[model samples]
Target: MTERVTLITGASAGIGTELARVFASNGHRVALAARRADRLATLADEITAGGGAAPIVIACDLEQPDAGDKIAAALAAEGVEVEFVVNNAGFGLFGHAIKLDRDEQLGMLAVNIRALTDLSLRFSDHLIRHRGGILNVGSIASFLPGPGMAVYYASKAYVLSFSEALRGELAPHGVRVTALCPGPVPSEFQARAGFLPGVDSLVLNVSPADVALAGYRGLMANKRAVLPGVGIKIVPFLLRFFPRGFVLSVVGRYQLRKR
Candidate 1:
């Protein structure tokens, strides 16, 4: 019998790569998509060397307008129906919104928000038709308004909100939509966001392996949301009860103090 196929965005590194590992270990034939094809190739090689299934690598910049169409076409041609999707490709821009280039901020939004939304909808449709599942990678930052990283936080908030709503809509169709809200994991993210130099102590962060395993299990079980770490699991509940003003004040102080 042919193995199940799962398409994972951002599969070149970090959470994405770990997610691929989890899925492949569970007997899924994975399709890896990321800008770095070499990285994906290396990861696939490692998986196969370890006696796990090798993933098909599809390299594409998801920020590009044609990325979604391209990926969908490529998968179809390869005869790999997407049995599951993990939308994990995203980035952040730190510093004041005015100080950052407008183009960069918008580009981050394009990737983090637009790409995620497009992938979710496309995969949701496929899953609804095929009885698949989806896991959208959100962030703990989504639960609070980030002052220094305003656009990034808002984009994640959209992710958390959308995942919840999508879960409700797709549940009856035997399609599960899981929102993965992780607090922090050491990865390429901090360096890219220009926040690497300032960080002293890490927060209640979980390993990418832990995050991926928890998220994968939740997605497979059709859980509505998966906040991997204990800290993150408790945060959204607090954010819901706290008034917007209080939450903002707390978030603002936390961020500004880092600078």
Candidate 2:
């Protein structure tokens, strides 16, 4: 019998890799997608050694316009029916929009916003039919404005908003949609985003495994939003009581402090 696979984007490392482990540990076959095929191959070997089925590795860059279509077609060719989808592949740029490379900022949008949306829509039909669901990886930055990292924060806001609306629409059809909002974690994100040295120690760094576990639980339980850390959970709640300008000012100062 063909195994129903859980497709996780950015599965080569960090939260995405941990998410794959979570699904596979619980007996779900996984399909790993990322630009790093070597890392995916290593992870697949580990999973198979631990007695889970070998994962299908699809190596492709999500920044391409037709990336989502390619992923869908690859799954079809392999006869792998994706029962779960985790849109965890995303990146951030840490700088003023005007000062940063416009193409790089736009590329972040391509992967974080456009790719996520396209993949979700492409797999929605299969999910609805198979009683499966989608888990989108958002960020606490989504709740407020970010000055230094404007585009990255705004992109995540779209993720959280879109996930919530989609959840409502899919609920009656037995398809679950969850948004996983995690704060700073010990991952490649900070490095890729160009955080200053020793900056991560300034704040609490949560583990990718913990975030993945929280996300998995929320996705299975059909929660609207999953905030992994307690400190992170209070952010969105408090933002509601403050004026928009005040909130923006606070967020901007925080971003400035990171520099």
Candidate 3:
């Protein structure tokens, strides 16, 4: 049997960190990857203290084009065979597309789109060979358009679409692909996305641990998508029935800068 290792990206904080904890607590050896090496080390120590095997820490900046290759190389160097991958590394920018810094917007695309795709494809052979699976962190934003956070919304849309398609393609091969669409969670995402304080209250807040658990369960079940909260679960149905323009308008208003 192929060795099973769960590789979690963006493991330094927030949902990614929580996901790592969940997997580790379940007795899964995880490889934690993020730009924050120090934070990864701390998490590794915590997991170890909890009696889980010491996690492999890899400091990676997924924004670089070659990040997927580097991660593969690093894992191979450690003799870790990834049986499960959590593509939980992504960020967003809040603003009109034209108003946001071009480089920053592109950087968001690089991390949120390019890196995820690259990694998903990069490990496909291994996953299929081992009957492993992938869990992609999407968002409620994936269900509809956001006029203000245009690029971010579109990126998540891509995530949802890609994950669904990949799920269909991989299922016959015994590989599962699950898209985790979570509503607002108490995480660093909003702050890093440039939301002003209190903006996160625009939606119900669930804990990162809850989201991670939902994702883990859904992935194991091989579900196509996992919507964590009640509010989030209603999103797809609402989007299907709502008028597109009306939905876009509401999102525009919601994303408006608050004083």
Candidate 4:
């Protein structure tokens, strides 16, 4: 059988790194893109040494305006079409919106919203042309409006809406689009976001490897929305019955309150 190619963003560590491993083990050629070239190189080397095909590593900040186009161009140069797409690059800011730096918010939007949308739109076209698949990693935060993390939650909400709507639009072409909405996955997320200083570990968390496995299964099943972790799965459903204002309030308090 011909090798299938997958393109994953934020592929250096956390969920991205684990996702790359799972996809490679399942026999898909991967294109791993991240800002941390050193980490990506190490991972690529390990994949090769472990007898899996080495993925193309593109060092992209994604906050840079041209990152998405660069990723597309690199893939074109390789002459290997991407059959699977994973848009998993994102970050969160821990402070109140008013207290956060303006540029910091912009940077957050750049990676969390702009880059993900660019890749989804760009790669969905590529997938449509090839009749393949797309997997977008959104957060369970999408179900509510977060106060301290307002922008981040809204960005993921956009991801959830955009992916589900696109799935309906792309189904006719044999293209499958799934959005994996995981909650509080134990990852570089809190540390990188600088939330480790204030947040309690008691809040729900899951392993990145577990998220990757759920993502792989969700994409294969063509699930519209994949919310792994039973506790996390209950969240989105609970949000539906409650008032939006109420959910937002809870998110704000939970996110901002230091235990």
lDDT of 3 by residue, 1-259 (tens): 5467899999999999999999999989999989999999999999999999989888989999888888999898887688898999999988889988999999999999999999898888889888999999999889889887899999999999999999999999999999999888777888888776454455656789999999999999989999987766877887788889989888888788542
Score candidate 4 by TM-score against the native. Answer: 0.94
What would the TM-score be for candidate 3 when compared with the true structure?
0.96
The local lDDT score (0 to 100) that residue 40 gets in candidate 1 is 91
Listed in order, each prediction's TM-score against the native is: 0.93, 0.96, 0.96, 0.94
- Residue range 70-96, candidate 4, lDDT tens digits: 998888887777888898999987778
| Per-prediction backbone clash count | 0, 0, 0, 0
Model 1, 80-117: lDDT tens per residue?
67789889999988888989999999999888989888
What lDDT, from 0 to 1, does candidate 3 have? Answer: 0.90
Whole-model Cα lDDT of every candidate shown, in order? 0.85, 0.90, 0.90, 0.85
Query: Where does candidate 2 have its weakest 10-residue lDDT segment?
Result: 196-205
Candidate 2 on 1-259: residue-level lDDT in tens?
Answer: 5557899999999999999999999999999999999999999999999999889889999999988888988899999787898999999989899999999999999999999999888888789878899999999877878899999999999999999999999899899999999988888888999875354333545689999999999999999999987677877788888999998887788778877
Model 1 backbone overlap count: 0
Off by over 4 Å in 3: 197-203, 257-259
**Which is better, 3 or 4, measured by lDDT?**
3
